[model samples]
Structure formats: C-alpha cells, structure tokens
Target: MQSNKTQQGGVLGVFPHYHWRATEQEVDMAMPAPAPRPLRLNAEPQNLVIDLRRTAIVVIDMQNDFCAPGGWVDHIGGNFAADRAAIEPLQALLPALREAQVPVVWVNWGNRPDLANMPPNQIHLYKNSGSGTGLGDPLPDGRGNVLEKGSWAAAIVDELAPLPGDILVDKHRISGFWDTPLDSILRNLGVKTILFAGCNTDQCVLHSLTDANFLGYGCVMLEDCCATSSPDFCTQATIWNVKKCFGFVTDSTTLLAALQAPPA
Candidate 1:
C-alpha cells in the first residue's frame, strides 16, 4: 500500500504573484490572484475607480497626544477640539473599510524613548521656544514621555483604538515613509493606492500623502476624516494642494457609499 501522506505548498507572502508554494515534487510560483474589488469613488478634480484589494487607508496621528485632554496638544494649549473632529468620522469609516477587506494602517508619531533617533530640528517643532515639554519630555501630569513609544502620549485614542487586524507603524519623521517600515509593509501587502486620514491635515497628513504620491502610490485625501488645529486657510490650502498637485480629495461619506454600492 502506498502512503497517503502528500506534501503541501505553503504561501510565502500576502501577494500572490510575488509569493510561491513549494512541495516535494514541484514549486508553484504562479498562484491565482484574487479578484479585484473595484469601487467608484466621487472625488475632487476627477472621479476614481480604485481596486480595494490593492488599496489601504492610512490614519495618521489620531492618538491621545493629539486629540485627548491632558495630552501633548492639550498641554501645549493647542486646540485639541479641532483634532477631535476626525474621531467620529473615523469611527464610522474604519469599520466599514475593514469589512470591505481594505487594510487599515495607523501611522502615529512614536519616537524612541532615548530621543537618540530625533534631530534638533524635529525636536524644535514641538518646543520652538527651546523650553517646556517637547518630544520625549515627560508630561506635567506624568503621562509618560511625549510621543514616546509605549507611553500614553503615543497610544491611539480609546474611541479609535486599532483592532486586532489593523496595522500600526511608528513614524519618527513628518513623512511616514522616511526611515520607516511603512513602504516595505505596503509593498509586501501589494498596496498600490493609499487613502489618507487623520489630524493636522496641513502638517503630518499632507506631508505623508505627498510622500506617498512621490513614491508612485495613488493618493486620496479623505477630507472629513482629517482635522487640523491650524487656521481654516491651512485646511483649504492642503485640500487645494491635494487636488491640484498631490492627489484627489474626497470624504468618508463618499468612500463609505462607494464601499456599500455593488461593484460596477
């Protein structure tokens, strides 16, 4: 009697083409690709038909430090309320995106505890006066270091805490791609398009979106899902730049509708 046990191939990565399965007799490299999940989104400048299978939503800096009371923004007297606006929209949109099988990437400022990776310029952004609480500085109420990894200042807000399947990337620079594993992670996941959302639209969000654009990824800004404490003009300018130079601009409502609509 012949043995019934047979060798089985194992998947190498998230993508089909790049990964392979190997057995005792043969190695199959041409795995069947999943069908594209295309959705039509109404956006500024023009409309778009994105493949959800190759797309991911990047939520930037939606952490306690930026949105919650007794955090960095609040401690500095910045208008934390403005940044809080993105919370409700995100609450509604993230679950829908997850349901649609779209990857959720949370890119927050999580610096090293020793501040060794930080430069003077980056530190100065938070402490322009060369005094007071800055990056890696302990909060007044002892809420751990500002934006330091594993600290309350670096944790995501409770309302928008990442679920088990969500991806978290700690970024030390304004651009999430700079000196970070974000690009590598997206590449491994076979993501070609990025939907941008989060706080300080003109600063972190805009810079990250621009970096994504430069890296040849399709960029889309979710207007209502991003907030800023800056003047209204700043928000306007960021939207204009995203539409004219960087990428398309749309809101979560439009995206949610697209996700729910039957694929055309």
Candidate 2:
C-alpha cells in the first residue's frame, strides 16, 4: 500500500506501506525477558490470546510540548487541537494497561546543547535545538525511564510524565530502534508483540511502526491514543497507513477486551 500524508502542517510527511517483512535469517535470536509478568488471560476462539508475560506497550513521546497547553509547542506552533486529540485517548489507555499488568515502555527523545554530540541529521541538514527540550517528560511514578532523543527537550512531556518502573529507551532519530537498545530490550522481555501508542503520528510514531513491522514484531496501533500536527488528514492517514503496513489498528477499548479474558 502507498500513502501520502502531510503532518505538522505539511512540514512532516508520512508514507506507510505493508509490503515489508522480516527475513528468516534475521529473527533467529531470542532476547531474554524481563521477569515473568502475571498471566491472567488466555486466547479465546474469538479473542486474541496474549501471554501478558510476553507483551509490551510502547508509549512514545507523550510530552508537555505536544499534550499540555502552551508548553513547548508555543514556540514551534503547529497543531494544538490535533495534538490534544491524540493525548486524551492514551491518557485513558495507560491506566488500563497498567491495571492489566502489561509492560509500558516510554520512548523519550533528548540530547545535548551542542549538535556535534548527536547523530548526523537524517534529513540531510542539521537542525538547531529548540529551547533545548523535547515535548514530553518522565511520568512522576518513577516507573518510567526518560529516554532523551536530541537534546534536553526530548524527555517525556511534563504533562504525562512516566511513572516509576518505566523503562526509558533513548534515541537520536525519528525511529526509536535506531541506535537504541529498544529492540534488544523487547527481545529480552520475550515481547513477541508490541502495542504502540504515542505522539506525532506523522514522524517518530510512523517510523517506529514501519521499523517494528520490518523487525517482525506483531504491532497493534492504538488509534485514538496518538496524534499529529494535523488533526484530521495526518491523523487519519497515520491510522490508515499504519493499519495497512506496520500492524493492526485498534482502540483502547478493544485492547482492554483482549486483555481482560480469563486464562487460556
């Protein structure tokens, strides 16, 4: 499938396709898992079976700039309505996932003031730091680890800070898998499937989803939980293209249904 999306007011474009697959030669490694999580559900004939013990929820960049009013976006000034719409849904989803005892990985972005300390820009030209901050911040629970992407600006947004016990996987590019231990962490946790939800659907979210598909991890995108600079077109394209290529499309309610089932 081919798609054309203009996000962040056409500043960011999203192109998603489904024709990619992981090769057999590349998936022979089994990464160790985090300690076994309590398994409370089984696969029903109609419902999906998830060994919660082997699943992970990756919450991407739900930061202050994107979610909170007048935080960081005031500077860049893209789409507040669009970003707000995205943050509201995940706010609800996180609690449900936590109740079900599923692992939630917070993907944060941040770097130093000097551009020289970062990976060379993927878009060709180097970009300057924006107030030295990422849009989000670590949730206060101490469970969330703050993964800084480009500069200090990359921490989890202050509005939806990660909780304690949360794992922080830092990166330098749009795709979280780039130069990050995220892949190994998921493998080690026996996480065969990934539940993806977060900010900027057009950028990091989209890239990560495609990469995840290439990595062969089952992806279930929580639709309402993620948003972009454009509330309508970009958001819609993200949901559509991601469903078409990277993984399945779903909402928080559907996810809860699958997770609440009795043991298999």
Candidate 3:
C-alpha cells in the first residue's frame, strides 16, 4: 500500500484553510487584567458604571453670561440659542441627580470686582469682540452686569437655580480649577468621578473637563446638557475629542438610567 502522504489529494474549495494552533507569541484573550495605573491617564475601557456615592455633577459656565439672552455670548453677537437649549435638559436631569444624592457644583466665570485678577488677554477679547457691555459694565438694558464677580450675569441662570447643598465655584479663567476652590472642594468631598454638563461645550465645558481629567478625575460628559455659541462643528469636535481621549461621552438620559440602576 502507498503511504498516506503519497496518496493525498486536495480539493479546490475548502471552508477552512487549516486548523488554528496557538503559537508562543499568541495573545491570551482570557488573561487576567493588569493592575490599574496609580492614576487614570485616559478614559479607555469606557464604562457607564457611575457610583453615585463617589460621583459629583459639575455644571460648568451655565451662568447668565454664557447661557442667557443678555449675557456676554450674546454681547459679542454670538447666537445664544444653543446655550439656551441646554436649560431644559439640565432642568430634567438636575432633580434626578439631586434625588440620587449626587453632589451638584456650579462653576461659572466670576471675575474680580475691580478686574484685579482678570487676565489682560481675556479682557482684550471681550472688549474688541463686539459693541456691547464690556466686563463689569452694566448691561444696557439693565440685565445686571457682565463678568462682575457677584453680578447677575455671573450667577447661574435663574432656571437652573442652585439648591441648598450645591457647591458654587467662581472661576476667573475658562478652566474652573484655575484660581478657584473647585479642585479642593471635590477632593474634600472625596469625589473621584465627575459628571460634566453645561453650556459652551467647546469653551468653558471643554476646558473644565480637560483640567479635571488632567487632575486624575474620571470624567463623564453629559452630551445633551452641554452646548456652545460657536459653530456646530466646534461642539462636534469637542464631543469627539472627549470620547476619544479625555473621557467617556454620554447623554443625560443614559446617565440618568445608569444612576437609576442598582449597583451590581
């Protein structure tokens, strides 16, 4: 009889070319997870798991200056509609987040009364941008003033009023952490995860989220509750960068659902 190898014939059509064999270099899909880093560098392995106990919702720059009609964004001839649209979603989300016992923080642009700590560059931007009330200048139509620390424009919008226990942080710069008590407050509260929602997605919201991520906080962006007066592409780019690099991107509904779900 002929040897088996000598008698073998191959078929033209075959479902599998060959049986798979594990090589020494082959990856082990079932390998145990490696130890997490001492600090969270990036928001990879996106998990919607939110611990309401250790989490806080940061409402960034939802002030009248950015969100309301007679504010700075509108002062510079920018359309405030997008910023206005964020209000209802925030209103819907705030109550649930508060009831769930998640801390709420309002971070808004509240410059010094005498413009002492205000950066010259920032002041320049506000001055040359449009023909409206400048920072610390009274609104022409009497809607308080713009960018004065305790003025109506610097306050959180009336619609999303801060409740009794909510944290209020006044920031001089776009990033709330700069020259403000925001970081210390979050640290003191033992907060590890930050849920970011507010107006001007490409500016204040983006800046604050970036700083939070840099400071090692796990960031979850509430997509629907953030907006910008810039072109729609800016908002798109901000969300894209957030999901791709800084943090997890989710909307109010998904976040509410996550918060409502019982822990595993």
Candidate 4:
C-alpha cells in the first residue's frame, strides 16, 4: 500500500499519489466504492412458450379493513394511503391483464364469529374483527368465493373489488401459501412467478415471497405497490428483506413495462 496526502485548509485528504512509503491500512481507506449492479427484468414472460392465457396475477388482502372506509384497521391508527396507492396502478394494469387472459385472483381472509372451524387461539385474536369476518363480507358482489382467514378482519377491501371470475383462496396466517390452497391453485393454473401487490408488506407479502421462493416459483414484490400497519416496517421489508433475500423488490413502472413489452 502506498499513499499521498493533500491538505485543504485544515483538513487532509488521501491521494493516490503515494509516497515511496505507505501502509496497507491507508490504501484500504481510499479504495473506491463498489460499482452499481445493473437492473434486471425477469425473463419468464419471454422464456415461456404459452400465450398470455398462461399467467395469473395474485392480489392479496386488499379488503376494507386494510384499505377503505369502515375498516377496523383505521380505527386502530392504521394508514390508509400507504395501502391505497396499490390500487391505482393495479386498476390501471387490470384491463391489459384481462385482455391477455391472465387470471386475476383476489384473496381475502374472513372468519365466522363462532370460529366454528378455526382454532380457539385464532378465534380469540379475531374476536372484534368486523371486516375480515362474514360479518360484513369480503367481496363486494360475493360472486367469487372468499377465503376467510377470519377469526375477525382478514378480508380484502372493496376498493379494488373482486370480479365475478376472480379466484379467492383462504388462509389463517400471513403467508398465503401456508396451509392454504394457494400453491395448488397456482400450479393448476400454471402460474410461475406471481406478480404480487397487496397489503402489509412486512408480514404477509414477505412471508408469501419466502414461501414462493422455497417452493421453487419466482416472486417479485412490487415496492411502491404495498403497505403495512407501520410505514417503517413496510420500507424495511421492501428494501432490506425483499431486496436482499426473499425476491426482487420492483415497482409498478417495471411491471407495466414488462406487461406491454412483447413476451420473450
């Protein structure tokens, strides 16, 4: 290691012009930062031979409690805008996905008051839930079946409401794949890398992506397209967890670009 020093007023800055004498430690401190990695777009849509008829988009837990009026989460100091933004882009993308024959699965959690089928512990947790339960209903039309994780408010919202043909899968926990029909249904429909956008990024979304990865399917967490009970956890999960380990933490722009571009 060799180093040269320059003086600026009262401070010293290291220069590559090393004196004939220098130590390894001095050189290490002056090393340039690593180069930025290039952005990568997933190639699945290009690689697969099937037509647009093959892909399915799974939109998770966007129900009233998580996104709209009369939702219990709002009563508990939750931020609505944090989750609502997911709606605009998704709504904007719907027409294209629909015309392309990609199935849009709307999943919401709901439970019965008696907790008839759920465990006692879960039943206790959902005791006061008003939205996720059958109390108010998950889907606006009640056409597509709703999967109630309901001990109380596990339902998806009415804003980006479910359509008559949208498939609904139920779950009792955060990861939609945990003890649920999600994996089976996706496999049946031939969904590989699911383009997901929904509520509570730190928990459900993160859990779902981890499961999706372990299960061998690809996953991407749309960054600006998700929210949590707290903004901090939302950003942390999207930036650190999803970006570093679980999956690609991308955005709506990249998604729409991938959608419009011809399949690879």
Candidate 5:
C-alpha cells in the first residue's frame, strides 16, 4: 500500500498538480409522501377494477354479540369502543348505498341449534379462551343467546338494521364463505364487486375479504367502517395487506363522496 499523504501547499506529491475541492450544490428533489388512498375510489392496482353498479355491500359480523355492550365482545375483555367504532360510519354509509340501489348483505355468526356442523377447533378455542362463553351460551343480559340462530345477540345492530329487501347470510366461520351461502347469494345477485365493512377487521373482515378476492370478486375495504378489538397495528396491517395484495382500501367519508359523485 503506497501512501499519498504528502501533498504540500495545495499540490500533489512530486507533481505540481493542484488539489481541487468540489462544492456540493443543493437540489430541489424532496420527495413527499404519497397522498392516502381515498374511500370508495376505484383504484386498479394489479388489474382489479371496481364497478359501483355491480358492487354489493357485505357487512361482516357487526351483530349484537360483537358490537353491543354485554355481548361476546365485551364478555371477552375487549374494548367495546373498538368494536363500536364502525357503527356510526356504517350507519352513515348504508343509507347512501341503499339509495344507490346497492344490495346490503349482513354476514353474521349464526350457528345451528345442535352445533352438529360446528368445527371442534373453533369450539375449543372460544370455550377455553377465558371468556367462559361458547357457542349457544346465553348472553349476560338474556336479550339473546350467543351463536344461536335467530337469537337477538346474533342479530345485526339496530342503527344499521337491514331493510325489507336486504339479504342476511349466516356464517359459521371467520370467513363468510366457509360453510355459508354468502357466495351463492352474491353470485346469484350478479354482484362482482364487494365493499366490506364491519367488526374485527383483522379476523372476520380480513378472512372474508381474502376469501372474496380468492373467489375472483373485486373487494373494496371500507377502512373507517371496519374495526377490531385488537391493537391498532393489527387493523393497520390488515389494511396494508388489503391494499398491497387483496384489494383496495378506503374510508367512509371518501366512499360516501364517491357514491354520491356523479358518473364521469
């Protein structure tokens, strides 16, 4: 290794070469963070396009058991507010969507009386999860029973109650399509695009959305209208994955505006 450190008087060693210092020039190249994706805005990443006219709203697991106080959510030590947060946005979005003639489908947890078709793993998980409640368990207030078909606790919230023409599909698993007629109903209705909103964004909402995407349905997640009892990171990660892979992500405000916006 040779040393070239003996430069003297702004000159290179043994040569009259001058030492040159280059000045750094400022650049106007500050890249700003991208604007967040808007609600109900049609974004076609990976060739997925959302058609509002063909879209149906699927509200997942926003039943009394999950959102109402003294229901399974509160019984499981979950913050009621976390599950209840979606109510207002859903209430606001539903009327507009209904007026637009979009079909409203409620996918809820409604198990059979015999629990004959219930999976053992799910039963064990919920029964031993320290909530002391399981399928067919009586709710605290006795207004309805948990997971029992046609029970009040298994019903949708009053604020966003289904109208006369709305469809109701009972689901046994986290994913609405698992052992349910949700897919058949949507397909029969000629629905190709689905907008999802409801409780437990990371669990039921994520599962159902993934299933819908897998079934080749264009999915749009109503971000503000989907919530979870888990930490915020869980919901954020769900939204990220949805936008990155599953489908589009938007909020209620943006969705409402998009729904009300005149066609181009």
Candidate 6:
C-alpha cells in the first residue's frame, strides 16, 4: 500500500468547519480548528470559561452622540457625564482584549442620512415630542447630523476610537441584532460568546444582550464597562435581570486579571 498526503491551497473562512483549501487537482475541507484560548473568569450567578478564539467584545452605543458633551444625550438634557463612567474601564479593557486576539465589535446608532430606514416608532424613541433634533437632524451645536452615518455624532468617542481591525456595525434600533449585519458578522467570525460593554446599560446594552441571548449566544455583561444616565435603580434592575434571565454578569477587573494571569 502507498501513502498519500493531501496538499491543498489557501485557507478560506475563519473557522475550521467553514473553511476549505483547494488545489488545481483537489479540494481539502478538513482544516484543523485553531487552538482554544480559554480564560476562566469570576462572574455573577456562576463562573465562566470562555474561549478567546470564539469570543468577541460587543461595545454598544459608546458614541459621541451618547457619551460626549454637545452631542445628542447632552442636547436632550440627559446626564451625559454618567455615561462616561464606562469609558475609562473600556479604555483599559479593549486594548487588552485586542492583544489577546479577541474581536472587538462596536454597535452604535448610525442612522441613514435621509432617515428612510427608520420607522416612526424608532425615531420617536429619540424625539418623543415629534419636534426637536432627532435622528439625522442637524445638531444645534453644528458638530454634525445627529447619529447620521459618517458624522461625528455617530462616531465612537475620541478616547475609545476603534482600531483598524475592529468591526463597526451601525444600528438603528436598541437591539443591535435588529435589521443589521451584526449577527451575520459574528457568525462569520465564528463567535459564540459575547462580552457586552457600553452605555445606557438599562437600555441599549441590556436589550442587545437579550437579543444575543435569544439568538443562542453566550452573553456576559461586564458591569463596570457599561454605564447609563438613568437612575441607580435602573442599573440594579438591569444587572439583576441579566443574571436572572439573560446572561451572566462580570466586571473588567476580573476579566483583565484573568487575561494577564500566567497561563495554566
């Protein structure tokens, strides 16, 4: 008997099962899976062991319109300063995650210029009185159109600008998964566990995490990495609902320590 080894061409997709390598004569679909980078972290409800190879950090609505002064939240008289709490922790956490090769996904409210895709209800969420600066409307400060795509209002905050390889998903609704390519992008990247962090913890972050849970992704809410201008009770309820219903809750401190700890 003679032994034959298959030699194939370039690899295809991110994950092993979805990837294929083809030569002029043959195609090899048996690419080996990447080594798992597992990190055990202390979390509420229970501890979690996540594979960095299959995990992504989803930072939701950490945009200028929500977090910075002279932006939408500030214009609407919301305490934008409160939302800034997540900024420092995320500043320290994201770079570390990127260093560990974990994907960073930013899901922010970047609306269509004409607001054509936005439903009346969605627009009403921001502009309840039906008259005032809302989605796509020019800000009184002349900074840019409110949350319009390609505007400063829609950009991530200066302190946390996304790196070249980071993924950005424009979301019109509270749930980033709705009517967006977010789920598809995660699926293509072979992401099974999502570490959620961003502003308005009781609203956008919580809703997005819930949607990810519904779609069967493992969700972990990084407590200190999420902030909201809402009242303190709101944060408590959001965290409770997350641990009781949607997913586990953890903080950046625990995660960062786990990431930096010597590999076992």
lDDT comparison, 2 vs 3, better candidate: 3
Query: Each prediction's TM-score against the native?
Result: 0.93, 0.68, 0.79, 0.66, 0.80, 0.93
* Candidate no. 4 TM-score: 0.66
Lowest summed lDDT window (length 10), candidate 1: 1-10
Better of 1 and 3 by TM-score: 1
The sequence of per-residue lDDT tens digits that candidate 1 reaches over residues 125-202 is 888999998999999778989999999999999999898878999999888899999999888777899999998899
Give a tens-digit lDDT track for model 2, residues 234-254. 777777787666677777766
**Best first by TM-score, ranked:** 1, 6, 5, 3, 2, 4
**Candidate 1 wrongly placed segments (more than 4 Å):** 1-9, 14-18, 24-27
Q: Which pairs of residues collide in candidate 1?
A: none
Candidate 6's TM-score = 0.93
Model 5 ranges off by over 4 Å: 1-49, 129-131
Q: Give the local distance difference test score of model 4.
A: 0.59
Say which prediction, candidate 2 or candidate 6, comes out ahead on TM-score. Answer: 6
Q: Model 4, range 1-264, lDDT digits (tens) per residue? A: 111334333223332221122354443334342232222354322222223433467777787666764465554455766777778877777666676556787655655434465665554454455335433234443332233454234556555666765788876666788778888777655566676777777767777778888998767667766766665855674557655665566666765676677644
RMSD for each of the candidates: 4.8, 13.5, 19.2, 19.8, 22.5, 5.0
What is the lDDT for 152 in model 1?
A: 92
Tell me how far candidate 1 lies from the true structure as C-alpha RMSD in angstroms: 4.8
The CA lDDT at 114 in model 4 is 42
Question: After superposition, which runs of candidate 2 have C-alpha atoms over 4 Å from their true positions?
Answer: 1-48, 117-152, 261-264
* lDDT tens per residue, model 5, 89-144: 98899899878767799999988878889878878867876458788777776766
The clash count for each model shown is 0, 41, 1, 15, 0, 0
> How many angstroms is residue 247 displaced in model 3 relative to the true structure, after the best TM-score fit?
0.8
